[model samples]
Target: MLKALRCNSLERCFQRVTSLAEARQALAEPQTILWLDLFNPSQEELQDVGAAFHLHPLAVEDASHKHQRPKIEEYDSFYLLVFYTVQAEPSPERLRVCELSIFLGERYLITVHSEPIPELEETEQRWTRNVRQLEGGVIVLLYSLLDTIVDQYFPVLDAMVEQAEALEDRLFSGELRQRSFTQDLLALKKRFLTLRRIAGPERDVLNVLTNRDNPLFNEHALLYFRDVYDHIMRVADTVDLYRDQLSSTMDANLSIVSNDLNKTMRTLTAASIVLVVDALLAGIWGMNFEYMPELHWTYGYALALTVMAVISLLLLLIFRRLR
Candidate 1:
């Protein structure tokens, strides 16, 4: 679906266009700033928009294709930026990343994404309610979009932090089964890695927009971009910290499991020794000798049993002392 919002220079007029053709018509107003958003557009639709705007074919291709890394590229007429929108799924083991491509020009901004972005909807509503917000021009629009995308990282990070804490509690409390804990830890690690992959480069992208000289962004707009960049840095740092925590947690879990196994083995070994001693005495007595002297004694059977019991008790006490 294609959605368009246009505001005039005075910020007094605002309109929403439903089709790409109507958006193109709105763009004809030189003093108007337009934001065109494409949600899961078909290849042909993307190509048509590209052709209409005279966008670089490479940029169009990147937008059409999925899984482009977060980046910013400068073209003669516009700037192309790719970013990932991240959200943690209901399951702690899962994460969702959606790619968003932006083409920012002097008077217009276009965004393309394969998934519905709640931030985009919020931004659209803000502009719809008050057109004056768009008076800062396309740069302000770009900043809003970036800020929204960066803001989303916090919730995902928060979810990860909660999961990490829960896992730690379970690990120390001995509530988590070893096998399941390992699986969960590994899964959380993967989620953190995925978040890092998205946030790390996206931070660099924002840095370029903020620190580097880009004709598309004026000095006033650069400050806003810097704010977004700072947020991204925070997210990146949190991801790194979480990764370290996960590693440490995994190590602690392994140590606990190893200690438990050692205790189990020790108990088994002690039991085996006692059983072996009992079996040795039984084996000797079972060897029936025709002239055994003890066999003739009236108390011989009682004496043999008492001796076996005493030996077993002594061995158990010795093992316990050693332990």
Candidate 2:
């Protein structure tokens, strides 16, 4: 989808442009310094856009396909920047990531995405809901959009920390075994690692802009991006802490399982000892000794059975005391 936002002269109005002619028309307008967009152009659309703007072939390819890492390339005429954005569906509990390729021209900015981002809707709402006009300049809009996406990381990381802390409490409570809670912790650990893998590199990407000798920001809007970068750092640190907490949680679980197994082995060993005593008495009675005078006595059977019962009871009492 192609979206154009014009904030140059008076009120802010958004336009949807599908064709190259319309895009070029928006780019040609002196007032149209900002363009927020998503493009999944086909073969024809790609060529048309490339020819219209004199876009480099590599930039177009990078925009079309997914890239392994975030990057920024300074073309002779324009700047090609590849950025990553994450979408967390807090309701459905799903996470989706995509790359955003931005073309920053002298007067206009173009953004391309492999998939749609709800940040577009959010940006619109921020503009429409407020009575105050957006301040600074075109850079404000650009920086605000980036800032919005980056700022979302805080709540996500914070939520993960809360969950980790809760599980840590449950881990020692001796109640985690009843609720499939251990499995839940493992799943959370996986998600934490996933979050870290994305956040770390993306933080580094933003850090470049923060440390840039001549940043890609206007003097007034620079502070906002710097603040956004700081939030990114907070997220990285939180994820790392969560990762460590998870390792400890796993170790605690293993210790509990081992303790349970030891209890089971002790019970089995006590039963085996009783069985050995009974087997010895039975073997002596079955022996074919011809001079066994007690075998002829009618009370012999009763006496032997009574002796076995007493011995078994005595062993049981001893085992109970040992336990």
lDDT of 2 by residue, 21-51 (tens): 7778777776665564756656566656667
In angstroms, the error of model 1 at 122 is 1.0
Residues 120-164 of candidate 1 have per-residue lDDT tens digits of 987766656655556677887788788888898898899889989
- The C-alpha lDDT values of all candidates are 0.86, 0.71
Backbone collision tally, model 2: 0
Kindly give the stretch of ten consecutive residues in candidate 1 with the minimal lDDT sum: 125-134
TM-score of each: 0.93, 0.83
Q: Which stretches of candidate 1 lie over 4 Å from their true place?
A: 128-133, 174-178, 288-295
For model 2, which pairs clash?
none
Candidate with the greatest lDDT versus the true structure: 1
Best by TM-score: 1
The local distance difference test score of model 2 is 0.71
- Report the C-alpha displacement of residue 91, candidate 2, in angstroms: 7.9
RMSD to the true structure for each prediction, in A, is 2.0, 3.3
Q: Residue 36 of candidate 1: its Cα lDDT?
A: 90
